[model samples]
Target: MDKPEKGNPADVQMSDPGKKSGKQPVTACLICAAFFGALGSSFIYGYNLSVVNAPALYIKAFYNKTWTERYGQPIAAETTTLLWSITVSIFAIGGLLGALCVPIIIKVLGRKGTLLLNNIFAIIAALLLSLGETAKSFEMLIIGRLIIGVDSGIALSALPMYLGEITPRHIRGSIGQFNSILICLGVFTGQVLGLPELLGQESRWIHLFSFLAVPAVLQLCVLPFLPESPRYLLMERRDEAAAEKAFQRFLGKKDVSQELEEVHAEARAQDNLQAASVLQLLKSPAVRWQLITIIVVMACYQLCGLNAIWYYTNGILSEAGFASNIIPYITLSTGAIETLAAIISGLVIERIGRKPLLIFGFAAMAFFFSLLTVFLNIQDTVSWMPYLSYVCILAVIASFCSGPGGIPFVLTGELFEQSYRPAAFMIAGTVNWLSNFAVGLLFPFIQVS
Candidate 1:
């Protein structure tokens, strides 16, 4: 494609980041596409968000109130605690493998293909869980979750990278904001169905795991249709004409020749530095600081133990002394509160800025977890205390939704130069997922102690 004379209309500078990325296609059609973008990864994040709570109840039932099950058998009280720890932490353990594989998947598969393949893992996991009914094998259930963790770990890092990279820059903040929205969507999906009012009527715990497959299937189908990341097409693959064409198509303009050249020029300068190795990432001060910041921010996001509540929502309610029958309702309420808080967050982001929101978010989170310790101790004496604990738990989730949950990936996508964004985010996100696995998988032990 020939470069347009320097003064092309599409060559003009964009004031809003959203406009820069792709805003002109804002009719009813593009809006639906945006929703599909949101829908794409909801389950990828949501499956992990909701899987933990319901199973813990059955595990508890197996070993009595004073104990918990291990490897499908009842265990002593001390071992019950260890058993639960293993069950939860296994998600993290599985994540270690997935995390290691992230760069490979994204690098080899390109952004879109890796995610589509990741969903295939989700389907197999659901099938394995459904098969658990016939075999009565707890191992299959844990292994199934481990596979999901592999997929989830990859998605947690890659989904936002994919979303952040592909969305209109102007709306990046809001769409990036949707990262948690979809995560909470998953939490909501799992919590709603897991509600004892619904599941209590029948033995349907399998329904929770089985239902997780639906979103994966949806993403699996839709992913092939959506445009692949323009950056990937142009930068990595060097399809100059196609990249410019994609950029123009995305912006809803035709004369993007200068923008096309800019894309090549930018990727060209950075492309030489694609000398990314684990050592290069570790040794370069700029890259290293970015990696550290990404990992720390992501780790802190999970350390609040949000997934503990999300994955094990029912278990959390039960521990606080909510009746097993009522836990799902409480979990759903958490989802509602999270949704409201996110809306308010979308409003406040422009005023608050990212760093301030993140710092305050983490500080508030540390305080809330401390409050959890106090509430758990009080659960022995005051029945009302459990309800307060539930309220506090939701408040913490709100803080996460409004703040840290969104910022880490957004900053990550921004901080690294375009050349390194994919690889850098891949590493940072792997850390995030592994940490989520740690906090979630070991949450039973963390809480018991």
Candidate 2:
């Protein structure tokens, strides 16, 4: 690696103990970028997932009232069910559309730029949802859901890419976990706000969607001051001066010659390659196994039944013989457990490595899920069995967040080289949202069966 010229502005190295430990210090700027970035992006995605649940009856009632006013008759039960299902499941469809747009959008906008523009979807969706009641239009609410889905799709891909690129290799896993942690926090926030005493009531439910603007606006204000991805600037834009400034800002040090050289080396190695398209990525034999691994992992990330838990928290508790009034409070615990587990995972992922945590999480989930089934079946025979089922639910959530909830995102970024990353994420996001759509559309029917 060639060192920067002695008089270069970014050539001054700060005194840091991590130099001796073969690690880099986590900087304030790096932390802010990750926190605010995920706050607006992945947080909204997770919030939307759980936010609809507590307001389900209220939303359905609004649907009915709108139908009655428009048609001079009440909606049929089957049609009501169908409309609600579409409202819940259409997010995935929008996400699929957004995922398809990743390659071109990121190429043009850059990772941070893509995220900034994505807030447009969130803000528009917020307005549509919050004002749908006053407008007397159910379609506005559905459209809003779809638009926000697009926002989430783009954010999911871009935020991980940005986080992965900005952080040093030593702390990459820890920083990447921010995406998952904020998601868990978002789920918990939705649950908290959805309480009847809060925004979950018929009159207050519209406010839930309105809250989306807060983080979006916050990110818009905070993120512009932060640096763009050093790798993106160096590799894609070939703007060495700007990349050096970005590297210095993110690393919180003046001497970034080694970091610059690493990216320069990668760029030289891929000098023959252009940013790949989805078709090209699919056809390339070199990345065949990498593509397969990402696809399988992303598919399982959605298909692993975690969403089912979020979608059916109330029903699950009710089935376990819990009183209706207490189930909402109990539901909050699941989100809390999820957030805690993800935090713990972030702390230890670099030390323990990704594969072990993933294997352990999946195995533990299987065990607890089976135990939950047994307890659910036997709850009627014993007074204590329902509590056991509750414990099992918590265990399953903890198991999931410990590894499987977050590692897939980290792996998607890690598995591919710079040129392939955008296309790779696009493919992974496609599988993810498709599987998510399948689960959201089919899970109710499957549960009934």
lDDT of each: 0.67, 0.88
Give one digit per residue, the lDDT tens place, for model 1 in 153-252.
Answer: 7776666666665655555566677666776677676667766656532377777777768877787677676666677787777776766665555556
* Model 1 whole-model lDDT (C-alpha atoms): 0.67
lDDT of 2 at 301: 88
**Best candidate, lDDT-wise?**
2
Using Cα atoms with residue i matched to residue i, what is each candidate's TM-score against the true structure?
0.85, 0.94
Query: Which whole-number lDDT from 0 to 100 does residue 218 have in model 2?
Result: 98
lDDT tens digits, residue span 317-410, model 2: 8889999888889999999999999999999998899999999999999999899888888889998899999999999999999999999999
